[model samples]
Target: MDAIYDEIRVALHAVWRRRWLALAIAWAICLAGWLVVSQIPNQYLSSARVSVQLRNVLPGQDNLMSQADQQRDIDRVRQTLLSAVNLEKVVRGTSLANTVATDRDVADRVAMLQKAIKITAQADANIFELSATIAGGGASDAANARLAREVVQKLIDIFVEANLADTRDENSQSLRFLDEQIAARQRQLQEAEAKKAEFQTRYMGSLPGTGSIEDRAGAARAQLAQVNSDLAAAQSGLAAVNGQMAGTQPSLPGTAGAAMGPARARLATIQGQLAEARGRGWTDSHPDVIALKNQLQIAQAAARGEPMAGGDGGTPNPLYLSLRSMQADRAAQVAALTQRKAQLEADLARLGDTMGAQPGVAAELASIDRDYLVLKDQYDKLLASREQVSIRAQANNQTDAVKITVIDPPTSPRTPAAPNRPLLLFGVLIAGLGGGAAGAWGLSKLQTTYPTVQRLEKASGMPVLGGVGEVVADATHIARRRQLKLFAGGAGALMGAFVLLMGIEFLQRGLVA
Candidate 1:
C-alpha cells in the first residue's frame, strides 16, 4: 500500500511539471477543431403546413372520398410532388441551378433534393407538414433562409395544382367516357324496340297479348253457327225447287205468278241470307253478300222461265227449260252448302288447336316480354348512371369539391439548423484535453531523469539514502528564468493561434468557392 501511494505521488508531480505543455497542446487541438467546424456550411430548415378538409355532406349523403381513401390520395399527391420531373422543375427555378452546375450531376442533385425535403402526416389527423433543409450556399445566412423559403413555396404550388387542376381534368375525362357509354346504350335500346315491333307485326292475330284464346274460340263458334243455318236454308230451298218442278207445269213467259212456289222460296232464302249479312254490318260490296245477291237474281230468272235476254235464240219448251234450270240451281245449292260445311269444320278444328296451345303460347310470349324488359331495365340503369356521374363531374368542376387549404405557409429561418457548433466545440475540447493528457504522460515517461527515489530503486535494484533539492540562484538569475519562461509560453501560444487562424482562412475560402 505504501509503495502504491508513493508511485502515484511521483506520477502526479511529473504531470504538474509538464502542465504548461499539456495546456498548449490542448488549446492547439481545440482551436483547430473549432476552425474546421466553423467552416462547415450551416443548413436552415423551412417548413410549410397544410390542412385538408374532407367533403361536407348532408344527411344520407356520403362523401365522394372516404377518410382513408382521401388520405391515400393525399399521400399520392405528396409522392407526385416529389417526383423527378417536379423536383427538376423546382431545381431549375431555384438557386439550386447554380449549385448543381458547380457541384454535381443532375441525378445526384435530384437525390440530394429528395433527401433534403420531407413530407410527413400525423396519424388520425388531417394535417400534412412539408419541410426542406437548405444549406446556405454562401457564407451569408440570409441567402440560405431566402432559398429555403422559395423552394418550399414552389412545392406548395405543385401540391395545390395537383389537387385542383389535375382533379378537374380527370373529372372531365370521366364525363366524356360516361357520355360515350350512354350513347351506346341508347342505340342498343332502339334496336331492341325495333325487334319487338317487328315481332308484333309478324304474328298479329296469334300473338299472346292480342286477345285471350277463349275469346277467339267464341268468335269461331259464332261463325260456325251462322254457316250451319245458311247451309240448312240452302238445302230446304233446293228441295222446294225440285218439288215444284216435278209436281206442276212450268209457268208461261212473262207470267205474273211465274216467279212463285219453290223458286220463290229459294229466292226468299237467298235474300234472307243477304239481309242477315247486311244486318250483321257486312257491306253491300262484301264478298259473301255480293255472291248471295247474284245467286238470288239467277234463281228469280230461272223461276220466271225467261228467254235469253238481249240475244237471238230458239224458243224451247217451258217445262223443259224450267226443269233444267231448277236442276242446275239445286246442284249449285248443294255444292255451296257442302263447301260452307267444310269451312265451318275447318274453323272449329283451328279453334280447338288454339285453345289447347294457349298455356305454352303464353309462356313463350312471357319469356319474350321478360327479355325485352330486362334490356329496357339495363338501358334505364345505364342512363341513370350517366346522369349521376355527369352531375357529380359538373359539381366537382364548379364547386371545387375537393378541399385543400394551406393552414401554415413557409417562413424564412433566422438561425442555422445544422453543424451544431456549441455541442461540436464542446466535444472537440474534451478530445483535445484527453489527447494532451495522453501526450504529456507519454513524454514524461520517455525522460531519463528519475524524479522519484522509489522509481530509481525499482529500476536499478539500488537503495537510495537521501534526496537533494535544487540550489537557490541570485535575484538576477531568478528574474532571467522567469523571463525565459514567459517568452517560451508566449511563443508557443502565438504559433498555435497562427496555425489555427490559417486553417480557418483556408476552409472559409473553399466553402465560399
Candidate 2:
C-alpha cells in the first residue's frame, strides 16, 4: 500500500513538473465530457399528484379510501394503478403517446418512472400519492403534462368505478337475501292470515285475539291428566267388585255386576230367629211362637220370589228404591266423565291450528345474523383488494404516486443552455500553453544536454581533448552552426502540431448544442 502511495506521489510531482502535460490532458478530458453533456437532449418533465386511502366505511373517511384493511388493500389497489396495462394505455392514448417517444422508449421511460416513484405504509392507514414525468422538446412540455394528468385521472376513475361496482354487488347480495326472506315471510303471513280469517268466519265472525283457542286447549290438556287420574281410580274401584263380594256376607251374592245377595241375606237372618223361638220349648199353639213362625214363612217366600199374604194390598219395599238410587248415581258419573273427554278432544284440535301458523321469531333473528356475518366478511375482503392495487401503483411510479399541483409553469428558453463558446476558445489557448510547457520540462529532466559540449563528448564514445593546442578555427567549424540552425527550425515545426490539437477540442465543444 505504501509503495502504491509513493508511486502516486511521484506521478503527481512528475505531472506538476510537466505542468503543460497535465494541463493539456485536463483540457482534453474536459472537452470530451462537455461534448457528451451537450449532445444530451433537453427533456421536459411534467408531474401530478393524487391521494388514496383504505379505510372502513364507518360514518365517512373524508370520502377517501374509507374501509377496513385499507393498508394492505390499498397496496393491492396500487398494483392495478401501476399495472403495465394502465401505463401502457397512457402511453398509447395520452398526449405522451403522440410525442417522438416510441413504445420501446415509452416502456423504458415508464420503467424508470416506476422505479423513481415512492411508497410508504403504516398500520391502519390507507393514504397514497401518485406522480409522472416525460421527456420531449419545448412544445412537448404541455403534451407531457396533459398526458400525466389524464393518466392519473384515469386511475382515480378506475378506483371509483371499481368501488362502486363492489358497492353495487353488496347491495345486490343484500337485496337477494332480503328478497328471499321477504318472499318466504310473505307466504307464511298469507297462510296465517288465511287461517285466521277462516277461523273467524267459521266460528265467530271475528278472529280470536291472542291466547284464544290455544290457551283454552292448553288449560284443558292440563286438566286432562287430573281427569284421567280420577277415571283410573273409578275404574280400579269398579274392578274390585269380585273382591268386595268375597269379603262381604251374603248381602252381596256375586261380583260387582251381579244381583240376589240382598234378598238371600234377609232370608238367612229370618230362619235363625225362628230356630231361637222354637228352642224356647213353646208349644205350636202358643201366640208368641205362632207369631214368629208366620214372620219366618213370609221372609222365606220373599227370598224365593213369592208374594206374601197380607190383610192390606202389598207395596214395593223401600230397600228397592235405595238400589235404584245407587244405579242412577253411577250412570250420571259415567256420563259426566264421557262428556269431559269429548270436550278435551275438540280443544286439542283447535290448538293444533294455532301452533301450526305461529312464526318462529328467534329462528328468524338467527338467520339474519348469519347472513349479516357473511356479508361483513365479504365487504372486508373486497376492501382489501382495492387497497393493494393502489399501493403498487404508487410504488411503481413517483409521478404516479402523487400528481403534483402546479402553482407555476415553466417559461420558454431563448438560447440553448449549452455550447460555452467563449469558454471553449479560452480552453484552446490554455491547451497550447500546456503542451509547450510539458515539452520543456520533460527535456529539462534529462541530466545530459546536447546544448552542452562536455555532455556530448561522453555520449559519442570519444576522448576529451584540449583542442586549443591541436587545431586553429576554420570555416568548416562555422558550417556546423548552419546545421544547428536547421535543427531549431525543425523543432519549431513540431510546436505547430500542439496548436492544431487545441483547435479540435474548441470546435467540438462550441459546435455541439
Candidate 3:
C-alpha cells in the first residue's frame, strides 16, 4: 500500500511540474472538440398518428369488399407512404423545396427524405403513425424543426388524397373493362344463336324428335313395342268375338218382329267404327282406314247371304248381334295399333339411316351447344360483376368508405431530438482533460529525472545515504507563488469556458423553441 501510494505521488508530482504544457494541450483539445461539436447538425423530428376506419354502406352483400381487402388497402397505403414520389411531394411542399434548384437537386432531396420519413402501423388496427426527421444541412434549428412538421403534414394530405382518388380510379377502370368484355360476349352469343337457328332449320326440322338422333331412335323403338302389344290384344279380342258369333243363330224360329241379322249388325258396327277412325284424324291412306274398308266389304256380303229376322220371321238373334258389334270394335282397334307400329318403324328406319350416314352430326351439335352455353355463362358472370362494381363505385361516390381521423396532429419540435449537444460538450471536456494528463505522464516517463531519492536509487542501483531539500530566496518563492496563481487562473478559465459553452447551447435551444 505504501509503495502504491508512493508511485501515485510520483506521477502527480511529475504532472505538476509540466502543468503548463498539460493546460495548453487541454485548451487546444477542448477548443478543437468544441468547434467540431458546434459544426455537427441537430436533428428535429415531427410525428402524427391517424386512425382509419372502414365503413360498410352495403350490408349482407357478397359483392362488398371484405375486411381483409380493406385491411390490405390500408397496408398498401402505409407501405407506400414513404415511397420516392410521396417523399418528393413532401420535399416540394415543405421548406426543403427552397434548397432545390434543379431536377437533380429535387431528386437528391427526395432520396434524403426517404431515409428521414417513417411509417408504422399498429398490430390488428388501422391506426398508423407517420414521422419525419430533418437534419441541419446548413439550415437553422428552427427551420429544420418547422420543415419536419410540414413534411408530416404533407404526407397526411397525400395519404388521404391517394386513398380517395385511387378507389374511384380503380373502380372506374374495372367497370370499363367488364363492360368491354360483356359487349364482346354479347356479340358472340348472338352469333351462336344465329348458327344454332340455321342448323335446326336445315337439319333438325326433318328429324322425328328433339335431341340427338340416338335419343329419337330410342323413343321410336319404345313406341313401336307399345303399339305391338296393343295390336296383339286387339287381334285376340276380335278372334274371340268371331267364335262367339259363329256359335249364335242368325234368327229365332217363333219370333214375329222385324230385326237385322248378325251379318247386318256387323256391317253397321264396321261403318260406325270407320267413321270414328276418320274423326280421329286418320287419313284414308292410313293402314287403319284401309283395313276398315276391307272389313266393310266382307260384312256386306255376309249380310246379303244371311236369313233376315223381321215381322213375319223372327227377331234377329240378340246374342249374335252383340258378338258381331264387339268383333267390329276389336278389328278397328287392331287396325289403329298396326298403323301406329308402321309409323314408328318408319321413323326408326329414317333415324338409323341419318345416324349411319352422318356420324359427326351429334358431335358437331354438342360442340355448338356447349360453346353457346359457355359463352352465355361467361356473359352472365360478366354482367353480374359489372353490376357489383357499379354498386361499389356508387357507394364510394355517395359515402366515405375509408375515414381517416387525425388522432394526433403533426407536432412542431420544441428542441432537437438528436446530437445531444450538452452531453457531447461535457464528453469533449473530459476527453481533453484525460488526453492532456496522459501526454504529461508519458513525457515524464521518457525523462531521466527522479522526483524522489528512492526512485533515483532504484534507477541507478546505488545506495543513497540521504537527500536534501532545495532552499529558496524570498524573491524566488514570491515568483513561484505568482506562477502557481497564474496556472490556477488558466485551469479555472478553461472550466469557465466549458460552462459558458453549455449555457450558450441551452440558450440557443430556448430561442429555437
**All candidates' lDDT scores?**
0.69, 0.49, 0.85
lDDT of 3 at 310: 58
For lDDT, the strongest prediction is 3
In angstroms, the error of model 1 at 239 is 39
TM-score of each: 0.60, 0.35, 0.77
Question: lDDT per residue, candidate 1, 118-218, as tens digits?
Answer: 98886746788889997744536667777888889888888877877766666687678767877877787787777666655654354322433455556
- Candidate 2 has its poorest 10 consecutive residues by lDDT at 399-408
lDDT (10s digit) by residue, model 2, range 361-460: 2244344445545555555554554454444333322222222232222322222233444455455445544655555456555634343344457588
- Pairs that collide, model 1: none
Deviation in Å, model 2, residue 274 alpha carbon? 52
TM-score ranking from best to worst?
A: 3, 1, 2
> Which one wins by TM-score: 1 or 3?
3
Winner on lDDT (1 vs 2): 1
RMSD score of candidate 1 (Å): 16.4
The candidate with the higher TM-score, 2 or 3, is 3
Q: Rank the candidates by lDDT, best first.
A: 3, 1, 2
